[model samples]
Target: MSDYLSNPLELFSVAGKVAVVTGASGAFGEVAAEVLAAAGAKLVLAAGKKAELAAIAEKCRARGAEVAEVNVRPTSEAVCDELVRTAVATFGRVDILVVASGKNDVAKIVDMAPERFLDVMDANVTQSWLVARAFTKQLLAQGGGGKIVLMSSARGLLGHPAGYTAYCASKSAVDGITKALGCELGTQGITVNAIAPTVFRSPLTAWMFEENDNATAVRKGFLGRVPVGRLGEPQDLAGPLLFLASAASDFYTGHVLYADGGYTAG
Candidate 1:
């Protein structure tokens, strides 16, 4: 409405915005941090691994972005709250939150102990909820609209034949939270959305990218379902992430932007 028609690229500019990225040590977390950093955002990165967190912070700093590192997981409400405080203390305000701190425990429902299932839920579902809760409180207090970009997976929409019982269940819960929060914060000008990628080049899935016979067979089998005829790369996620984190997606919320290569289409 303000008329940026002359330079539409402004829609994606996150210059000087403050962002909080959890799971800063993980695959998607690194992508989120680097993307936000390259897009000119001040960063507050959190993770359980101090060395990894510091590495991410250093990369962002190298990009000329101010970064605050917190070597802790958002496992509890108190820790989540403190993370928000750190953002404000370092950057004055928070504008975006990327909940990337989650894990997958691959075990069939029959073989997985109840404790294992519960642990996966706590890591994926409970932690995401806590971080979102803390970030939302800060956004409301700051009296401005914000963005909450949640990390989901193709497993959220499609069931896997392998041992993905816990992983699938957890991501489905993430989708629910994204929708619920989007509705609740709509009036407040905040947007909530998720990025669901099937499989990308990450440490956990690195074997699928190898040139060995096992990797080749597995890759071919998987690609049979992917209409795009290729596995996902990290850059495949960057655009969608930028869109959700910037003004380009101001009118969009409660949506899941699938970065999969059409794997979920069928």
Candidate 2:
């Protein structure tokens, strides 16, 4: 091995790499963009809103990283293709893709509308597949390997009786997609993985963590199940994300790295 490769820490360097992060406006997406930029990756941030994506781009730029912003919804193949094109046009090539855009609707199966369930599936599963497919095509064209990180939820691995039917089902599909794509793309030098996190303090879940009696009761119940005795933080995902995005995880693919504070360990 070369001198640079001889150092263990050097394996985690993403310096000079180009990355495209979808759902850049969301909480986890914001953290992904910031962390990747800090790790020296040039970034292209895409999300549903232009203003939000622009804001994230500005933050990333301040970190001394090159950043491009694209307003896009990854549900359409055309939009997904355009996102990859924009990244390649801006940064020459993409080395990483983080699909962090997803939606969850809290409704019991008995009361869930078909449209609502489909919406969650489209947002979480279908959109993720489209984006990954487009990004993979670009990676194949360039004849270089890349990393794809899909955001899943701990609910995918465990059942929840609290009206998480659609969300859980959608995330479960994401996990399957991650494994399937990993198997198909391994020979092409692309690694596919998912980060499944437990309840985190994101805008979507802010109500659940609010300083209210109901929220406190909910938190207490959740804490009892989590071995770590706390909820996941945005920063908690940074290290695992960076590891999977870097050369250190070259031999690892189709794996679900649970950042659930040992909630799934039992």
Candidate 3:
């Protein structure tokens, strides 16, 4: 993992490469992009809000990355196409794609509004597919293969007591896409993978952790038993992120690496 000259394999260093990350405005995403930038990547950050993305880009630029912007609207074609095009125009090549766009709503299936379910699915799963399609084409043109990471959830792997039907189904779709994409792109030197996390301490997850009488009350005993004895941290995910983004994972495709601190062990 050393980028030091003393270690020859350090060529795996992401220096000078370009990485395109979706959902760049969010906490987990900003952290991930910072990690990549520190390790030497020219970042192309895409998020919904222009001002938020401008801030993320400013930080990455300070770290020496060339930046670009894309809104996550109309995922079917426009945004994804624009994302790939923007990166290529700015950095001249695409080396990594991190599909971190997501949406979630906890409601019983019976009560989940049709619009809400569709919105979550489009954001979580459909956007990923659209972006992958764009990234793959550019990766093929670059001709050395590419690394793709999809953001999924532990909810996709297990049943939850809460009404997470829509969220769970969307995440499960991410897993399936990773598998199908791995097969379809493997022959072209593209590796596709998914990361399923459990309750990471990010803006997306902080709401649930805020002590609510009814919620935290029901989970008082369970909190004491998390095997890791601590909530998931952004730093805790860096190692695996690096692995999947570098040549170290060249042979790994269609795999979902769980970083849930034993949430699925039992």
Candidate 4:
């Protein structure tokens, strides 16, 4: 108990820990890598974009983090297993995993092809499971607690007017996986949780942050529902990512921490 009271900040320290972040080139993934790197964790960054992955790797290296870049995506069991193996090979073990690899294909259900919906599910749901499975296996073999942070969205819980059937369905599945795996791994000292964010500052949504008419109109409507009265910034995710990735969130599992600025509360 004294350990909890003394140096509370120490609970958030991930220094010297090994972290594997998929989709390291994506918005949330980039922030995850940056946070882990700045906090002193060795990083294994995986993404399909070679150049972007290398850029992120260099950025982490600039922060004095030992980084291993893997030009791959968690599209298959073998690839996901390779991510875990690479982490273990480079850092001897993985203490944290951030499944940030996912995509959203917006189209009305009637207009969307079956293949498109399946693609979203494969990216957002199946890949999350694959990476978690691989990471859990490694954690069990190593005999220690680990953290798995899966990316979800407000869309998981709320519906959007603009063609989000595929995205919504996929994220809901991710939420389910988080809960199931969290319970499954609780006894093993491993915790599985997810960060479900609303619209935040990212390349895909950058236009909404602009000063144009369309941007202003969209922002106005979106902000009407957000009690915080603003969209999320990348910095908004830094704290949650750090919390879930560190000892601070040890008691939290099978949970979805929404970083949506109260967008879903109403």
Best by lDDT: 4
**lDDT comparing candidate 4 with the true structure:** 0.95
Error of 2 at 176 (Å): 0.4
Those runs of model 2 whose alpha carbons end farther than 4 Å from true positions after fitting are 1-6, 208-211
Clashing pairs in 2: none
Q: Which lDDT tens digits does candidate 2 get at residues 80-134? A: 9989989888888999999999888998889999999999999999999999999
lDDT of 3 by residue, 1-266 (tens): 45555775664577777899998888767876887888888888888888888888788878876667675642768667877888888888899988777888889888988999998998888888898888888898888588999998788888777888888999999999999999989988889998888777786567556679765754455556468755688887787777888877888999988888887775
Query: For each predicted model, how many residue pairs clash, with residues at least 3 apart or on different chains?
Result: 0, 0, 0, 0
Writing each residue's lDDT as its tens digit, candidate 4 over 49-93 gives 999999999999999999999999998999989889989988899
How far is 27's C-alpha from truth in model 1 (Å)?
A: 0.3
lDDT of each: 0.94, 0.92, 0.81, 0.95
Judged by whole-model lDDT over C-alpha atoms, candidate 3 comes out at: 0.81
By summed lDDT, the worst window of 10 consecutive residues in model 4 runs over 1-10
Q: Residue 162 CA error for candidate 2 (Å)?
A: 1.7
TM-score, every prediction = 0.99, 0.96, 0.90, 0.99
Task: Decide which is better by TM-score, 1 or 2.
Answer: 1
Superposing every Cα of model 1 onto the true structure, what RMSD results? 0.7
Q: In candidate 1, what residue range of length 10 has the lowest lDDT sum? A: 101-110
lDDT of 2 at 27: 89
